[model samples]
Target: MRGLKKEARLPTVYEVIGVLILFIVIMFGFINLLELPIQLALFTSWFMVIGLGLWIGLRYKKLQDGLLQGISNGLEAVLILITVGALIGTWIAGGIVPSIIYYGLSVISPNIFLFATLIICALTSLATGTSFGTAGTAGIAMIGIGQSFGIPLPLVAGAVISGAYVGDKLSPLSDTTVMTASLTKVDIIEHIKSMLYVSGPAFGIASLLFIFVGFFYVGNSVDLTRAEEAMGALQGQFNISWYMLVPPLIVIALLAMKQPSIPTITFGAFLGVIWGFAFQGIPFLDAIQTSYQGYSIDSGIEFMDTLLNSGGMVSMLEVILLILLALGLGGLMEAAGILHVICQTLLKWADNAGKTTLTTLIAAFFGNFFGGAAYVSVITGSKITEENYDRLNIDKRVLSRNTEAGGTITTPMVPWSDGGVFMAVTLGVSTMAYLPFLWFHFLVIIITLLYGFTGKFIWYTKGKEYTENYEDSTVNTTKFEA
Candidate 1:
């Protein structure tokens, strides 16, 4: 018993692969063919992973520790989810959301709406270094505005996601941005420049595509009756003044000051509660209640009421549950040496810089797929591939860039991921619905892949110095040792 306790069994590659194949099939089948909630699939998968852990000679206690550690990786995101929910609910009751909608309907041209939504969200996330805030605030308003113009909500959501993610990727204040930089041992500025090399063109391409697609929706906006009615209802219900913007401004200011996200967002939520009482003439108790249960109204205008009635602490319960289960499943996989076995199998094929980069990306992606958090994914990807990168003489910054491209940018596409679940729940658009239209993310990932194969942005480091070969841009890591 003591000998067994001292060391856990390592599962063979065959065991891990068989379990993974089963997990993927069931996960997709539950989500697609059965049309069941993802929570059920995640719940079911947790048990299967636990069985694997026990079968591989790992103790239940060790597996539980892995689960807790995985959940800890997302503890920040969990708090943000809860806080943002209350912020949304109270912001609506306080007239903050409506003000944006009221003014958005007044000035935003339908012809340029999609293009405009992308840019507005991009800038907001860029400044605040938060996609959740950008989407929950400006993205919400963009949805209402786009719907008023008769545009499909999914298209608008795609634009919002593209803009939000792009800005978050490049923002100096973003946690993922800094994490990816530090793990690769690269200067943050150099890391940002390397990402810009790929993301910049992807953004330009996405912008052009949005601009072109914006014209197609021109017919939808020709009749502004919905817009006119929404504006009128917004004005009748709330003050619709500039002061509504103050809450978000304060949240942004706090974030700018490098305050942690949890308290900053919570402060914004309570501020909304105060505004609901002061400006909307609601009783203090009722306003606070809205923060817990979400805002509600019988405004006679169906769409206006639907648009405005959202956000609350309770509304985030399901998302929180998903996070817990997903992280638990990730923990089980990690503790049983399942992910390590798979990553090693994947690394065997990484013979060249391009292949190594691509393999590193797939590993990062699988980290999100199985690890269930960006922090773990980025760290796991960087650590697993660091040795291969050193052996191949490729710069680790490129590895870091690939990590973000796969780990962070592509996170919102995975339904079980924290980012994916949050975006889907917040924007009222399913991840699958908006996924096809995430032009920027898709473009950036594709560009990163191309760079790996064609050696477009692949950089080589010399010896142990980690300095780039500035004079010889064509220095090839694939041939560095050959």
Candidate 2:
């Protein structure tokens, strides 16, 4: 990995802003006007970075080194992404994910269906640590069940997305959680602990909203015939046993012990393969193959087939590429001193801890909106604001928490973004249709900003003295000026 040379000239703030505007225009033009996929759009942006570096008078070697350094930082996350993909494939084949959905479906009644939908999806996503996986599997089942109960599709979609993302933000197994912790140099457990102060309240309030909504549809009678048929098809294809839970349980236990993420997730994937072979009676060869090619189920039920037939190492290739390309662009900007210059400009306004936190939050949202990926937003926000946080004596965990609160939760709100597009396509509901019902997403933004302004949960550190202070720290505006 390359470090920025002290002698390298930094780009001016106006030049950085111009490059950013150009970058956004190119990306939006490709994705919206030209109708290209996100991968191609990202590729086009990488070239823009190269051109920007040259225009700024940076040597080619310096720019290339920055790109490589940025890509290197994400290598561990990429491995974890591939491992989680394999885990999903094997978990489905082993009946782990299916069992959760099957059991969740069996317990819900029409009256509490909406509330239960949120809880079930949350639990499934917590277990799998993947919002997309949860959405494609249990989320589909919830949609079918909700339709059967005559609930509005948008409401159901909202509950599913909210619950799925809650787990994605909190779960130890979640890639976003891992990436956030790593980027901020905070212990994974500490990052999660800090997040609870924000996510816990947001999730609780959202659940209550779902419950309130549930009251209206409680007595409305509808058929459960289709849901039963789907459950039957799942049961027929897989063993659907409690024993399938061993893998996720082990993962949680290991994470609680503060075990490293990569090995823990890899072990979980291996346990899933063993369980599939031993209990599900999947052929040994097929179990191994599924880790790479994904689980294949021919239940003859179209919806069931669509939901269950996902995961495997191949499924993560797009995400891996996106991370690499986005990080590369970030690296090029850093190498050319553009990121540092812009962040320094932002720091001019961050005269206090509260304003610093708010600045990070604002930057994160803009990162998701302009960068077009949650990973990009997280990396960009964390990298730029980390030193400002350090200078303000703020705990890194708080930085990681805010990054996720703003970046991860806001991506799905942008309709053209990859996260938004995936959720809309998976649930067959437009992003705009479900936008109003996404209480959890909206709540996170509000809660984080509230905490920033109010300093309710800010953790402070100054030269080894740690304290939890709820009172807002007075802004020393002149102390942090360049």
Candidate 3:
């Protein structure tokens, strides 16, 4: 478990091939047969896949060390997930989430619902550095509002999630973004800037799609009935004042000043708890309940209770579980060198920059086929393509761009991936239901491939400049050589 031994290691090729086969069987049982609940199926598959890895690692007496190494390697991500849970709990108790929901609902207009969903979710995601948080806090409210307006639910959720993921993918404060950059040894700003080539077009196209979709939203006769009722209910439950906005504002301010994510989120959560107690005069028990079990208030409206009563550490458990399971699967794959094998196999198809870029995109796309998260895909794909990019004289920027485009940005479209599952659950929509409306992800994938085909985005430098820019700086450690 501590590390790979010299003689007992399995070949990367077999490891990757086995992983692919295992996932295919799992996907078949879940998606085609519909044999179990999605969550259960996911958990079961993750366990089975990891069990296989453990079995292979256990062939030698050193298996215990390998297991410990695997778990230890995952410690950072586990801490991040735990902090995320705490952050969600505190945000709800603090009134920051409620405030955002209140204001977000106030701005709703049928004429601009789609674009508005995008903008609001994007801002929320940027603030929280979490698409899941944005979706749970604002996406649900938008969905309810959209339903009230007689707009299509899936399309609204799609626009909202697309925008949310955009911010989540780009924000320096995002855990996934930070993890990707750290794992790849790229500066966060450089990685973000590099993504602009792909993400920019995707965002624009998604916005345009939302605009077009908005036109189809035929106004629902302006339903102030529900809105008024919900607002009144909200006011009755909490001290509805401007002051409730301070904590979230401060969190954003801290992020702008380049504070670290765990601390920043923890700070926001702490202030949220304070707001819950001070303004609402919630009892200590109630404060604890609200932070962990969520708040419950009767506001003379059933829907309002359902909406406001949502929060707590408990609300985020599903997502937190998903993260743990998905990351566990990823850890096993890393331990088995499955990722390296997959990368090696794919690199053989790249004969030119165009092919190399396409191959990278394909590798990323296939990553979700194994049911992990976007950060896993991006890091794995980036490492896989680094050597190929250098050999083909492609810039590292190009490699980074493709990885973000096909791996990071597109994860939410795959139902098995962490981002996808989280978004669907948060918005109360199915992944397939919103697939057509996720124009941003599609656009990014398309633009990246198009650039590859046209050779427009490809840069080949000769002499010191090319050597300096295109040379691979990727660190190598597939086996536990040490």
lDDT of each: 0.84, 0.75, 0.67
Top-lDDT structure, candidate number: 1
Question: Alpha carbon lDDT of residue 471, candidate 1?
Answer: 37
- In the predicted model 2, the residue pairs found to clash are none
How many collisions between residues are there in candidate 2?
A: 0
Runs in model 2 deviating more than 4 A are: 1-8, 110-114, 117-197, 217-223, 352-354, 365-404, 407-438, 454-482
The lDDT-based order of candidates, best leading, equals 1, 2, 3
TM-scores for all candidates?
0.93, 0.75, 0.82
**Model 2, 327-431: lDDT tens per residue?**
676666657666556556776799776788877877777666544567767876787677677777888988998899878898788664556755775576888
Clashing pairs for predicted structure model 3, backbone only: 1-65, 1-66, 1-67, 2-65, 2-66, 94-272
The TM-score of predicted model 3 comes to 0.82
Displacement of the residue 74 alpha carbon in candidate 2, Å: 1.7
Q: Give candidate 1 misplaced runs (Cα > 4 Å).
A: 1-7, 218-222, 463-482
lDDT of 2 at 149: 53
Q: Write the per-residue lDDT of candidate 3 for residues 172-264, one digit (tens) a residue.
A: 777777766765567889878877777878788888778776765445344656666666555666666678778766866776666775676
